[model samples]
Target: MFLVGLTGGIATGKSTVSCMVKDMGVPVVDADLIARQIVEPGRRAWKKIREVFGDEVFLDSGEIDRPKLGAIVFSDIEKRRALNKITHPDIYSEIRGQVFKHFLRGEQFVVLDLPLLYESNRVSSYLYKTIVVSCDDELQLERLLERNQFTEKEAIARIEAQMPLDRKCQLADIIIENSGSIAETRKQVEGIIKLLRSSNHHIYNRVFYGGIFIVVLTAIAMLMYWIFMR
Candidate 1:
């Protein structure tokens, strides 16, 4: 599978580009979704966090108080690393599983949507290109304020928590400037996908022939218990 790493700073329209890519029927493995799944009330991560940080981090509904926890973690690098130490492995495991599933399905291309792609060191080596959606700091601040109802300072805090956009863009294989309209951004995504479909022969071969082995193994794993139990 051709696996592209997608990333951008907070509120820089990464979500918009990801959605558009999905809307156009490309398979996307969203790290954010996986992160959320791993942190739900009864999940191992949640239980561990509760044990470590105690009850004050939970709400009346017995769920982790994300905002409260975020406040503490974001302000301190050690705490931030501690939180990531708890969550990143689980999320990465989930991501690997999903990508393998997509590969087994004979998919020619897939996107790994990770917000902290560069910050997390996920972009250093990849099977496919890395794409960074970016906007200027001022525009990012404005868009974040409008989208999340965050004050300018609040948005800046979140943005500051990430590496600078310019640095991220410099690392990207493809820099998608998302400061423009939806049409412009979508056009860029569309053009990139179209070129990739025509240009990537290795991916075409993997999907056409090698993927059958993957699919058969996945099927065996999924159905083995049913067959053996009977």
Candidate 2:
């Protein structure tokens, strides 16, 4: 399957575009959802977090106190990297598993909805293309403040923590300008879906990988036969 990486700055409407793609019948492996899941109460990441950050970051019910953790990491770059180190491996593992499941089901393309697709670059090598959803910086700050109820300072800190939207757009194969109306964003998404569907890259990938598999099997068989003959 052709893997497309979808990313954007915080509050840049990346989620909106991701939903549009999903609603249009494309498979999306959501990294944010996977990140939440991997850090649940007793998961490996949860235990590591508990060990590293101590009991303060957890609630009485044993769930990670996400807001508390977010406050820490967003304010401190070291803390954020420490958190990423703990959770990223598990997140990527789950993402890969989901992508493989979709590929096995013969999906032509799958979108990986990642917030830090460029920052981490962990899965960039596997992507057939990348789409970055972006908007004006001021609008992004306003949306984040309203949606997250964070003070302007807190919101700006979180935004500054990420790679800039302009840089992301520069690296993107396709850029969806989300500074306009929802209708405009939807139109762009539709065009992107049409472009992806028309590419038919998945067929070529499958054939290429299948040929390699066959070649390996044939080589192993020939080696076994020669040993037996000897």
Candidate 3:
């Protein structure tokens, strides 16, 4: 399957682009969805988080209070890193498993929708191409404030927590500027789908298989290491 990494800064309309990609009949493996799934109350990641963050981050009903946890980690860099250390391995493993299933099923292409794609970095080397959906920072901040009902300061803090939009644009193979109408954005996404469909399939297959091979080996090694350390 042709693997594409899709990412952007907060409030950059990346989620809209992901939905567009999905509507076009190609599967989009959502990192955010998988993230929420892995953190449900009974999951191992949830237990690890409770152990590190304590019961204060949990709800009365025994679920993670995400906003409370977000208030903690987004304000502190080290705390955010600690959280990622616990959650990211499981997230990546699930993403890889889903992608592998798609590859085996002979999918023509698939999108990996990630928010912190560049900050994480490891998945970048494995994708055939990367798309960064972006808008001007002023608009991004405005959108963030409106969408999440956050004050300007809170929105700015969240934006500053990730890599800059300009830097992400530089790293991207394709940049979708979401500064216009929804129709305009849809046109851009459709154009990308057409381009990917027209591109050489063999090249994509080579890159995907080569990348997934290393991913499988690394995952196996890490699992063994975790088992031995335990």
Best by lDDT: 2
1-230: candidate 3 lDDT, tens digit per residue: 67899999999999999999998998999999999999998999999999999999999999999888998999999999999999999999999999989978878788999999999897888788899999988899989989989878888999999999999999999999998999999999999999987778746576867899899999999999999999
lDDT tens digits, residue span 1-230, model 1: 67788999998999889999998889999999898889898899999898877899999897889888987787787878888989998999998899889877978788999988888885458646889999878898988889878767777788899989999999888989888888999999999888777766556657666688799888998799788887
Off by over 4 Å in 1: 204-230
Highest TM-score model number: 2
Model 1 TM-score on a 0 to 1 scale:
0.86
- Model 2, span 49-161: residue lDDT tens: 99999999999999999899999999999989999999999998999899889988999999999999999999899899999999999999999999999999999999999
Per-residue lDDT of 142 in model 2: 96
After the best TM-score superposition of candidate 1, give how far the Cα of residue 122 lies from its true spot, in angstroms.
Answer: 3.6
Off by over 4 Å in 3: 202-230
Order the candidate numbers by TM-score, best to worst: 2, 3, 1
Give the TM-score of each candidate. 0.86, 0.96, 0.89
Backbone collision tally, model 3: 0
Clashing pairs in 3: none
Among all windows of 10 consecutive residues in model 3, the one with the lowest summed lDDT is 200-209
Q: Name the lDDT value of residue 12 in candidate 1.
A: 91
lDDT of each: 0.85, 0.95, 0.92
What lDDT score goes with residue 126 in model 1? 61
In model 1, state the lDDT of residue 96: 87
